[model samples]
Target: MTKTEKTKQFIIEKSSVHFNKIGYLGTSLRDITNLTGLTKGSIYGNFENKEEVAKAAYKYNAKRIGNKIISALNQSPSGAINKLMAIVDFYKNNWSVIIETGGCPLLNAATESDDAFPKLNIEVRKSFIGFTKIFEDIIKNGIEERIFKHDLNIKEYASTMVMLIEGGVLLSKTMADKEYLNISLKRIENLIHNEMKL
Candidate 1:
């Protein structure tokens, strides 16, 4: 990468955790400067302002979480059911890691970005919708392969699945109880096996 790109990337990487752990309004330019050990002008030189950096940091954080699930999906064996289960397994395994980073990025962004950061709130919404697409694709493939019920409501199921997962993460993080998240995921598993599966 070029020097400019590298420096911007450095700022994003350094500030991502800070933004995720704090919020858009909670994090300050000074916090980023402190985290990156860069002067205020240097940070401003790389980013238009703190808002721009926060947006990139949100995306960076979201990508980190998404990549984990994508890796799980890639390593998973064939069968739509197995892929679906692999998603559940990914969440179960990654809960601690996610908790350390101050909960899920999309959730954090959604809660904080509203009213204050309109663009960011939109990005957060897009991120959640993107999550729904993953489940939709999985279910669609399952139905195509005759692995899932033919009559499944793809949109409803996908949206519900994503909502439940996000809710689970929220509850788990807020309550400091992993079981809440596990229970949510277990319910999802049961929903797939009993209702969606053929």
Candidate 2:
């Protein structure tokens, strides 16, 4: 890549964890410079301002977590049901890692930016909806393939799963109990097995 592109990427990589760990209001341009070991001029040259950098950092963090989920999903060979289980398993195993930087990116952004930053809030909502749709698609496929019960409600199940997961993450972070996160995940698994008879 070009020098400018490389520098921008470097800034994103370095600042992602910091921004995630600290909300946009909490993080500052100085924090980005300190984390990246770049001058304000360099950072500003790469990004228009703190808001621009925050957006990029958030996207970087989301992409990393997304890849992890996708990788776990790919490991299951038993089709959509197993893939769905794998998705849950991934969350169970990596709860700490997923929340280490910023609890849930969508949850963080939604709660923090919703009223303050309309544009970013919209992006966060879209991301959450997109993720729910992934689960919905999986459920639909499973039903079509007879892996999941035909009576299953894909939209409802997907929404419930996402809400539970996000709520669990938030509660766990607030209570400082990783076990709560696992319990929440187990509940989801039980719900899925009981509903789908998997």
Candidate 3:
């Protein structure tokens, strides 16, 4: 990467932790400066404002989480059911890492941006909808392959699946208990075996 590109990425990478942990509004330019050991002018030299950096940080954090799931999915068998189960297992196995990274980036961004930051909220909404679309595609493929029920409501099921996963993450993070997420995954598994599967 070029020097400017590297520096921009450096700022985004360093600021992501604080943005994910503290939040968009709560995090400040000073925090970014402290995290990157760069002066305000240097930071501005890379980003237009704190808002721009905040948006980039959110994308970086979301991509980090997305890439993990993509990796897990890639390793699983090439079947819709297997892929769905892989997602559940990914959360089951990586809850600690997820928690350590300041919880789900989607959850954090949505919670903080929903009412306050309209510009950031747009990105958060797109990221969230993108996830639901992933689940929907999986379900659609399952039906086409005769692996899932033919009459299933793909949209509702996909949305619910994503909701349950995020709900569990939120509860688990708030309650400091992994079982909340485990229970949620258990529900998904049960639905897969009993409700969705052919």
Candidate 4:
């Protein structure tokens, strides 16, 4: 990468966790400068504004989370059902990293940006849609493989699972009880298993 590109990535990587932890409104330019040890001119040279950097940092955080999920899913040996369960397992194992960093990026952006920031809101929406599509694709594959029932509505089921998982993350963070998240995930597993048997 070019010098400017490398600097932009450096800023994004350094500030991503802080942005995710404290959020866009709560984070300041000084915070970014301090974290990256980059001068104001340098930082601004790479990013047009604080908002741009915040958006990029949020995307970086989301990409990291997505990568972890994809890695776990790819590593699972069983079929789609086991792959789905592996996703739940990943979240449970990474709960501390997730909760400590802030919350699920989707939930954080949805609650923080949906009403105020149009650009960030759109980004969050697209992330949600993309995540749901992953589940949808998995369900469709399972159905084609004769694992999931033929009558199942892949889109609806996938959407419901995504909503429940995101909601469960929020609840777990709010309640400070990981069990809430586990229970929600168990319900999803049961739903999938029952549908598969039909």
TM-score winner, 1 or 4: 1
Segments of candidate 3 deviating more than 4 angstroms: none
Report how far residue 5 has shifted in candidate 2, in Å.
Answer: 0.8
lDDT of 1 at 166: 89
Ordered by TM-score, highest first, the candidates read: 3, 1, 4, 2
lDDT of each: 0.91, 0.83, 0.94, 0.88
Q: Residues 88-175, candidate 4, lDDT per residue (tens digit)?
A: 8898799988998888988888888977778888889989998998898888888878888998888889888998889889999999
**TM-scores for candidates 1 onward, in order:** 0.98, 0.94, 0.98, 0.96
Instruction: Name the candidate, 1 or 3, with the larger lDDT value.
Output: 3
Better of 1 and 2 by TM-score: 1
lDDT of 2 by residue, 6-87 (tens): 9999999988887777887679899988998999999888888888888887777777887888888778776776888888
What are the clashing pairs of model 4?
Answer: none
Of 2 and 4, the candidate ranking higher by lDDT:
4
Residue-pair clash count for candidate 2: 0
TM-score of model 3 (CA atoms)? 0.98
Q: In candidate 3, which residue pairs clash?
A: none
lDDT of 1 by residue, 1-198 (tens): 999999999999988888988897799999999999999999989889899999999989998898889899999998889998999999899899999988999999999988889989988988888888999999999999999999999999898888888899999899999999998999999999889988
Superposed by TM-score, candidate 1 places the C-alpha of residue 38 at a distance from the truth, in angstroms, of 0.4
Ranking by lDDT: 3, 1, 4, 2
Pairs clashing within candidate 2 = none
